[model samples]
Target chain A: MHRNPSRPLSPHLTIWKWGPHMLVSILHRVTGVGVGIAGAAALVWWLLAASEGATAYATFLEWATWEWALLIWIPLSWGLIQHTLSGLRHMVMDIGAGYELSTNKTWANITVVASVLLTVLLWLYIFYGRG
Target chain B: MSMEIPLGRVRGLGAAGEGAEHWWQERLTSIAAFLLLVWLAVSLLRLPGLDHRTVASWLADPFAAVPMLLFVGVAFWHLKLGLQVVVEDYVHDDGSKLFWILLINFASILGAAFALFAVLKIAFAGSAE
Candidate 1:
């Protein structure tokens, strides 16, 4: 038994030509796991810290706002946004709408862009509008 | 023409017929989560800051605390359901998939319980802090 020398195997990521809808579809799962798991941990920590004492709350805030923490914080926020938007897109499709190739791709594109834009605007409101 | 046997014609859908329940729960929770999550983002931004007093007093209110608890409960529930599928789809080994699913269930419950406890504590005794 022999396989073709140059043939790509089943379910290989590199074998497929990528599309916007595929990116959004994959992002839906990626964001769901990332935000649901890691973000919940952070939120729970925040809650616990707040429940304990002012000193504990301060400690949590200090790290949460630390410059390096932005790496995790930003992505967590973005993932939450993307997951929400993509879930909405999926909901539309789930209801037996948006299945046409063009409609599906269009909504996928919108989900990607809106998620990013909304995340940015959220931060902007936090930093600038609040001030 | 239907590909239905006599028994199949009598019973509709999957063998267990509960797959749709999982799917329906996911979507139901998603709708709730979407609304609650948006509310959370907006409420957080409304606060002057994330200082202990500001945040604690915010959570101290029934209005704030209730939604947060719902968010925690709904979110963890949704994640458990969603992650179960993820593990099933990806983890080919039966033992491994089962292990992951069990962990997800236990961890989600623990996480939601912890958050709920914290929120409750704040609501009851936040001012004392």
Candidate 2:
């Protein structure tokens, strides 16, 4: 790809407002690409499972039980939550909403907060009991 | 006389009308993709080191099957959208831009459908043997 020196420079993170919706859009793309990488890793795991015997698969099973895996899982879950919410925001914008400055900001705030909360609840479900 | 524009030619074009349509569809599918993506991620995490049978069982469940297919479809759509913008912006040559646009669209859709079909066959083929 040819880099265009003359094209307008995109807003730098340092100079940017770092508002909720803006942050959401940035993170959504980041996390979407992140998921794609993680999915590739999972695909490798699948291929390994297919070729290797059950014992090898069990080793992976043991790894899955670790707290460290949970640490990784939390961010992934958060990514999912953030991406899904941001996508919804984009869809709403597609249909025309939150165009007014105030409404846009409010919805953006909603998306950011909801995503984190959802991620937290997901971890709670995984780690703690329903009771 | 310099060719005078007909009323139809002037009025027919909406506000970058077709561009907007493409943009909206991209976004709509992206939303769908994101939801299905979450499902796929969570399901994969759950799988860990499941055997073929257990994995098949999970895939066989309609819950998993439906989302997997949806994820594939939506992912391709989103890819198509993103690539379209890239082609439009970067490839100024009309011939090359058109070629890339068509090529990428074809490849993405085919890849998505093939992936979905492969997963579905493994899930439903009824023979773990």
Candidate 3:
């Protein structure tokens, strides 16, 4: 596979001076892909639990309680949070809210901060509060 | 009343109304998704090492089953819309962009449909022999 030297490469994330809208936009794509993978994993677990009988079900159980599940869920929760918040931002833009640069930055900050806060709260509920 | 503007003069490659359509559907879906996520988080946390029967029973509830399906469908559709824009923005080739946009929508639809069908069948199916 010969690399095409003539074709210009896209700008790298690190090189760009990040703005709020740009940051949120990048995070949205990242989280969307992450959530898609998580969705697939959930689907697999669901199908296995449904069709396979008690033994396979127990296998899922083992995985669900392990640290691995926490590892997965924390990021997945954050991903979902980010995706949802960013999605709301897009929806607001569609309706013409936050079209002003000031409002746009405010909402973008809200999206990122809210997603992080939600993720922390989720973890607290799952670990400290529940168990 | 003043004479209406001429169609040709006014139209200017008129909008497909995608803005309103996507905006409305996305908002509706986001609301559905938020509610569903609450249930989902609680339900998953509440699961005490679910045996097959317990898992099946929870999903069998019409309230849970229906919303779960709707959430997945809406979530995927919203995802497709968002990703389509990203792909369109970044992918410079017109043919490639069109191909990807179509592919993304098709894949999400199929995925959402399959998941919905599977869940519904399990939810409503006659008792397993």
Task: Tell me how each candidate scores on DockQ against the true complex.
Answer: 0.75, 0.16, 0.26
Query: Each candidate's TM vs. the true structure?
Result: 0.88, 0.61, 0.71
Global Cα lDDT for candidate 1: 0.88
Chain B TM-score against the true chain B, candidate 3 = 0.75
Off by over 4 Å in 3: A1-16, A63-66, A100-102, B1-24, B45-51, B125-129
lDDT of 2: 0.67
For candidate 3, what is the lDDT?
0.73
Top-TM-score candidate index: 1
Q: Which scores higher on TM-score, 1 or 3?
A: 1
Query: lDDT tens digits, residues A88-119, model 2?
Result: 88778867777998888898888889988988
Tens digit of lDDT per residue, candidate 3, span A1-131? 77799986666755777798888988988888778657654764665456455577678777777887788878888988898889878877877777898988899999999999999997887678655
Ranking by lDDT: 1, 3, 2
Q: In candidate 3, which residue pairs get closer than 3 Å at backbone N, Cα or C atoms, i.e. clash?
A: none
**Candidate rank order under TM-score:** 1, 3, 2
Candidate 3 chain A lowest-lDDT run of ten:
A44-53
CAPRI-style class, candidate 2:
incorrect
| Lowest lDDT 10-residue stretch of candidate 1 chain A | A7-16
